[model samples]
Target: MSVPPAPALPVVGDGLLDRLLPSVATSLGVAGLARPGDRVLEPARRAVVVLVDGLGAELLARRGGHAPYLRGLAAAPGSRSVACGFPSTTATSMATFGTGRLAGEHGLVGYEAYDPATGRAFNELSWEDGPAPRAWQPHPTVFEAASAAGVEAVRVGPGFFDGSGLTEAALRGGRFVAASSLAQRVDATLAALRTRPRALVYLYWGDLDKVGHVHGCGSWQWGEELEAVDAELRRLAASLPPDCALHVTADHGMVDVAMDRRLDVAHEPDLAAGVAEVSGEPRSVQLHCLPGAVDDVLAAWRGRLGEDAVVVTRDEAVSAGWFGPVEDRVRPRIGEVVATMTGELAVGDSRRHRPELLALVGLHGSVTLDEVAVPWLCAPARRA
Candidate 1:
């Protein structure tokens, strides 16, 4: 049996964060930044980019009743959807957004990626004893470019993220303002805007995504969280300083996966055969096979998963433009064979992943419309 072909790939190099951020920075006169073709933001003295994790365009449209503010933005004339790169997870999207580069260029391929130097699956978010963030992703970020060009860049998020690995790799060069609550984050963003004539504020809200992961995206808990986020966004928009714009976007969308649809690779002999490690999130799995075992693993996965997944070799994925011109240095970090969940099914290795991870109700990191498409809601500054 052969693996089914992948679904149509997302349009990379445009309508995504890699271009969106650079265009935002360019609008602010950031040196070395070029304007993207589809410029979404207008020239403004200050810009507030709010990243709502797991808020997919489809999810937002489906659950619009719960988020009036976001819904209105979505209904606006120029509002549109953008695609996060392949394996549309937080770490990968953030790297692309921050650096204005693809996953291949930034090298943060997924939540968990193979670090060739360490020969282990390292968590990109945690980055504990792994490679140095600067060394791992050496690209200068949009925030850094803005800061260098005399535009104030500030990041408002959790206190622990001030110097975390992901922050350093993708989001460094901004004034780190630790704000735990949504209200606090909004206040911090407003304050940062007031301090500089030209500023770029990046605010992160994760409650909805967290709730979605545990309770599923369609659950009441997720709806409640979305309401809270919508209220906060309303407040943020209403409180924006003069000549400022608030751009709301998300890292990726998610889908609810039933436990019955999840395949545990650890218990399956053929799925585990010739596999050295299983990294990446459940929805998009990376199989690092043993020497010359790539064919066996691919065949095994293709035969078992059938039409449920799109399994391809690393080279095939790169050629298909999944990672967007993968560089030589970043090649080995990718798995020998990659499997992306095309539907509601997920593949997990229980031996490697935690029970909580395997039990996650909502999952992303695939190219499905529910996972890759996110809203780009623009709320220009309005006077009181």
Candidate 2:
């Protein structure tokens, strides 16, 4: 596919994280603080990127001791945090990381969106059973680019994701290695790294995120999971062959919305008046208002949501760089107004759908520092 030039949008205050440049620059041989090229730019070598599903920078900062390996990475000189794009949700942020494009361009939009074409909420993550991957998101991932460039790329995750819709749309390029256990995943990642001199191995761990969503980020189980994952990374780092590098990052962070703050649109008539549809997560509510009701929607949302959220029109969000450079194709996916939850939850009729969402102990999809910021950790490759 021909790479189209990104639009000429002003690259400022887009709320899109600038911290990702270092990683992209490092991977592609551009100069940056954590430039992998400095050490592993050799034509034949290995590079490992471990993506911990729900680990955020703020979470790391508060509970550094919980994960010693990751803590050391964050505290290391030159380590920093990057902002996840608007809504700060996992699917959207991961697509951005994989394709190196904004949500507007990739068109993943949110975790669940009312697919205009389908007239129902399309869940991108589970689309393997929901829709064809290419039909949902047609863009080529950066993994494919690396593979075609002869840089061997491998994706190591759980068995369930081997052929899932999320994998195809955002992570289609690499060879898939499904491992159900952390030990298995770590082993698979190390094995893939040893196969080629120049390799990109992407590893994913989702248990922490799962625990957080179930028990909230404050649970001891979630902290223990972080420690366990960190221990696995440390083991992998120690076993790296000579002349390699390992980098650690995440899709986004988590925020635990209070139960008292939960507002059901079904029961709240004022909040439902102008809203044509409510998609995205409760924290990041995408309000598709009735025709000519954009202003009324904004006002109602602001008046109702109050200081608990950052309410902005879709145009304002695009102008503010919320989605990076908005592409012509991605514009329609955004609603006339979006309310990013700040201090509470704006849940739908949880009785009808999203029991898990209502039960989630930890939440995300907001601009709060906890949800948007992620860490960048780099270490010299381990040599055998």
* Candidate 2 ranges with C-alpha deviation above 4 Å: 1-44, 128-131, 382-384
How would you encode candidate 1's per-residue C-alpha lDDT over 68-184 as one tens digit per residue?
999999988657888988889999999998999999999999899898987899888888677989999998999999998999999999999999999999999969999989999
User: Poorest 10 consecutive residues of model 1 by lDDT?
Assistant: 5-14
Q: Which candidate is the best by lDDT?
A: 1
Model 2: lowest-lDDT 10 consecutive positions: 1-10
Prediction 2 global C-alpha lDDT = 0.73
User: lDDT tens digits, residues 1-384, model 2?
Assistant: 122222222222112432352354345443323422322332225678788888988898888888888888777664667677765787887787777667877778888765665545666677733556667678777677677767778999988887778887777886899998888999998899779877878888888899999988888988889889989998988888776777787888898777787888888888788777777877787877888888877787788888887778888778776777777766777877788876756565553356766777688887777888887777755445
Candidate 1 residue pairs in backbone clash: none
Q: Candidate 1 — number of clashing residue pairs? A: 0
